[model samples]
Target: MVPRRRGRRPWHRSRAYRLARTAVLVTVLVTVVRCGHDMPHGGAARAGHAAAARPVPPPRPLPRSPATTLRVPSVDVDAPVVGVRLDSAHQLRTPPLDKPQLVGWYQDGPTPGETGTAIAVGHRDSRTGPAVFAALAQVPRGSRIEAGRADGRTAVYTVDRVRVFDRDDFPDKEVYGPSRRPELRILTCGGLYNRRTGYTSNVVVFAHLTATR
Candidate 1:
C-alpha cells in the first residue's frame, strides 16, 4: 500500500510563530513608552519664573573670521571643518571616509569657541569599525578641544561634562542655549543598539571656551 503525507500548518497559525509575533509587538510597545513624548524647555509655571530671573547674557562676538578646521589631539581627530548651513541637507559637513576623524560645524549656529553652544558631530564607527570620535566616550572632563580659523587664530576649550541622552529625548534648548561664556557641545551616538531602531542614545561632551591661542 502507498503511504500518505500529512499537511503542515501555516506559519501564522503556528504556536511558535504566534508567540514570536506577540513578543515583537511587546518589545516595540516598550521601546515607545521608554522613549516618551518630547517635553518643552519648561512648563508654564517655570517659564514665568525663568522670565522673572536675570536676563540671559548676550552671545559672544563672531570672530572677525570663521573657523576652518577642528583638531582634538586627545581624541586624535584632525580634519577640515566646513560650514553647515541650517538649510543644508546635512547640518555638519564631514570629511571623506578616508578622513573619518573630521567633523563638521553647524554654520547656522554660533561658531565653535563662541558664546551660545557650538555644535559639532562625528561618527563613532564606520562600516570597517572604530572611526573618528571613536575614543569620544573615553574623554573625561577637562580635556582640551581646539579649532583653527582661516583668519589666523585658534580657539581652545576645556571639557566640562559628558552626558548621554536618548535620541528622542535630545534636549535641544539645553544643548543649543545661549551662554555668557563660550561653550561647545560634541555629540555622537551611543548606548545599546537595536537591530530595528539603530542607536538608542547619544553621548554629548560639553566644553567651555577657556582660552584662545
Candidate 2:
C-alpha cells in the first residue's frame, strides 16, 4: 500500500538473506580449519607434526667373516684363533691346554666382525701356568682390540666394560645374546681358583667394533 522503498530490492532486506550470508561465512571458516589453513600457526603446526612422525633409520649390519687372529695391544696378546664347536653337553669346550696361547671362536655363531655377538674364549690359566688370557682381567675399558679375519679384513673394537660373574650366577643371555651392531666377548675362567671345582667365576670383556680395514 505504501510506496516501495527508494531502490533496494525487498529480498535483500529479509532475514533469510542475512541468515544465508552468515551460513556461508561459517562454512568457509570450518573448511579452512579442517585443511590446516586457518591462520599463521596452522601450517607450521602441521609441518612440525609431520617431522615428529618420521621414522628412525635402523642400525647398519656388519660383515661376517671367519676370524683368524686376535690382538690386544694393552694386554700384549697376539693369539691365533681356532674354530670350536659345542660339545655333547651343549657347553663350549675349552681350548686345548697344550695350546694355551690359542683362542677359540664359536664356529656356529657370528664371526668377530659380524653384526651379532661374537665370542672368543681362552684360558685364564692352564695347569702349567698362566695362559693367553691370563692378563685379560687386567684389560681396562677404552682399550683397543683387533681381530683379523680370514678374508684379510681387520675389525677394530673398543672395550666397553668388563664383568665377572660367579659360575652359579653366570648370565648366559647377556654374554651370548644377539646384538644390533658388531660385538665381541672375550671370556675366560676367573675369580678364585678351586682345585676341586675349577674356577669359581668367569671374566667377560664387552667390546664393540668401531672400525674395519
lDDT tens per residue, model 1, 1-213:
101112422111111111111121122111110111000233344643653344444334446356688777776777777654332222234334444556766555567556655667666665556766767877778888888877777888888888877656666556555566677777666666554345556677888776777
TM-scores of the models, in the given order?
0.64, 0.70
Best by TM-score: 2
After TM-score superposition, the amount by which residue 145's alpha carbon in candidate 2 deviates from its true location, in angstroms, is 0.8
Worst 10 residues of 1 by lDDT: 30-39
| Stretches of model 2 off by over 4 angstroms after superposition | 1-61
Question: Candidate 2 at residue 213, lDDT?
Answer: 78
lDDT of 1: 0.55
Worst 10 residues of 2 by lDDT: 30-39
Superposed on all Cα atoms, the candidates' RMSDs to the truth, in angstroms, are 16.3, 33.7
